[model samples]
Target: MYTLLSGLWKYMFQKDEYCVLILGLDNAGKTTFLEQTKTKFSRNYKGMNLSKITTTVGLNIGTIDVGSARLMFWDLGGQEELQSLWDKYYAESHGVIYVIDSTDEERLSESKIAFEKMITSEVLEGVPLLVLANKQDIETCLSVGDIKTAFSDCAPKIGKRDCLVQPCSALTGNGFRLSTEWLEWLLTVLGSNGISCVM
Candidate 1:
């Protein structure tokens, strides 16, 4: 009877949660992306001033529930020194949302190196990666195709993980539609894999 009751309770009210890691190089718009996500999804969320968003020193975390699923996002500092600590959270991450400054052509190579390193980490094996070519509203922003082409060689090195590249603008919210699509995709993956979003 105890087992039966427990099963019934879960069947009636079970929530799926997922841990998402947001990574990128310094000034890559990681924090802004996170804040935008929260503002867009959370209930009655009062948003911060985007222009006031500063570089993260350690981490910023937020949670949002979509249907029966809850997404826990970890926005980590992108400084060169802070990057060494990224591996610490890899084992627990269900997915990765890598933000890139699409308008910053000068740092493309540097960003690629950082991206390659993160996706190639043994701890990140098989984790789904959603690459956001952020700041797309900017005049000089790279197209999603161009960004993909730049990372073409290194992308294949990401193992068997599922990946997607989409354009976004964390500041203007011009590309938030992609964020919705991404969450739906993530939910489908989590369901098929029987992954629990408990962490």
Candidate 2:
């Protein structure tokens, strides 16, 4: 009777869970973005000091509840060696958030290469993609249009997925709310259709 009651309680209250990946080159502010996201969405979550955050060496996990859905974010390390392990989590991910350091003009091409490789994977086909141009608070950072233009060649590889390149600053939390709202709306729509994954 106790077990039955517990199960019933959970089933009635549990939010639909979705896995999201936060991918980008090292120093692209993936961890910072995750922290800011958590701080913003979870009312009682006092996130880490953004300034003290360092490059992710392995993986950082965070969860945020939006409406009836819970988004579980996998913030992976972006170092060259660590990037090889990203695909290991691709099979279970519901969406992908590819972050780019807009201020790093020299590495923009490198970032594009990594993004192209990730999006073209069969496992991630049709998964919703959110491209964040981080560090938008900087005066000289590349605009969203510039990044979109730089990534134009790879658009065909992205297929028919719901993809957007948004300008954001993880440090200042600019554009963060809008991005999460987009995810919430997308997830709600997909959930209503009885689909767990975007495909």
Candidate 3:
């Protein structure tokens, strides 16, 4: 039984990664959100993606551990056309994150579209969703109520969707800790019940 014991030890030492998909309209600060997350728990993770423009064609993958589980954050393309291809990844996603460019009043409609597509997609149902209404530092951001109303208008909450709208400013690192804190809490709850999350 040496082989069996060795295999069990290997599995026990291995860390499981939960896939968290982050999506938003172009310039919604998704890449920045990830960079900040890395910087938070890690000793010194410099978030340079903040200054660069991102056009995510495939996917931007980032990993951070909550307790024992490594979270894989997927920073999806915010470009209008690329977003059309996002449905394929939903099947592989463990959770959904809708990042909003709160400064872009005109693009709020697009966020509605993305959130709608995710809620309606057959593979994404029942997954917990967190909507980061980002760019709160900007003067032109829509209020949290407005963003929530937008989602409520789409008719998902009434149907049993786990969602939260948090006003965040990734540029200044304003509300990131709150969001990640919730993430840790959620993972803890799920893990306690044996959700296969690696600690």
Candidate 4:
């Protein structure tokens, strides 16, 4: 009976929860990425068709349980009009996943500006960041290093935040495993910092 009681206690009281925000410019595949994540982690999750995905006008939310932690992702719209509302979620987010379209070289400068602005926000100071240079399957796509260099201006502004830039093809599920890698790192960071994961 002691083992049963201990299991019950852990199930009831030892859940770790975290909030994550997904942001990027319009048509950068934010919604598709969210759907892919849900499908990847959820056993019975029946989300929208990947090929039919479209621009997210407002927000898309998803939750997944890995180990003892429950991660809640708030995928905010990336349109120019919706970008201003991103700060509303920053204060609550434990980390951020900023997506970039590596295949769209013409918009690299624009994305860089947006990234710099987000990282510089006071509310998001010290928040860990995962920058996904998506669309790696495209032959003409920019490399992960190039994407990182483009956002190099935001380095100083990152300050205490942990940051990583990884290449991914959300459409083809390439490099998706990196998501789990980052989540593990995030847990370690929270533990070392004594940060509460309840939110």
The candidate maximizing TM-score is 1
* Candidate 3 stretches greater than 4 Å from native: 155-158, 176-180, 189-199
lDDT by residue for model 3 over 1-199, one digit each (tens)?
A: 9999998996887776677888887788888878877777566556565667466676887887656577888898878788888887887777777888877878778778877777788787667777788988878778888877767777643256465667888777885565466576557544553445444
Expressed as tens digits, the lDDT of each residue in 104-162 for candidate 1 is 99999989989988988998888888889999999878999999999999967877777
TM per model?
0.92, 0.90, 0.85, 0.89
Residue 121 of model 4 has an lDDT of: 93
For candidate 4, the per-residue lDDT at 140 reads 95
Worst 10 residues of 3 by lDDT: 189-198
The collision pairs in model 1 are 17-197
lDDT, candidate 2, equals: 0.87
- Give the C-alpha miss distance for residue 86 in model 1, angstroms: 0.4
C-alpha lDDT (0 to 100) for residue 160 of candidate 2:
84
**What digit string (tens of lDDT, one per residue) describes model 2 on residues 1-199?**
9999998988788778888899999999999988988988899999888999998999999988888778889999999999999999999988889999999999999999999899989999888888888999999999999999999999999998777777888899876564566566557545654546322
Q: Whole-model Cα lDDT per candidate?
A: 0.87, 0.87, 0.74, 0.83
- Evaluate model 1: give its TM-score: 0.92
**lDDT computed for candidate 1:** 0.87
> Where does the lowest 10-residue lDDT sum fall in candidate 1?
190-199
lDDT-wise, the better of 1 and 4 is 1
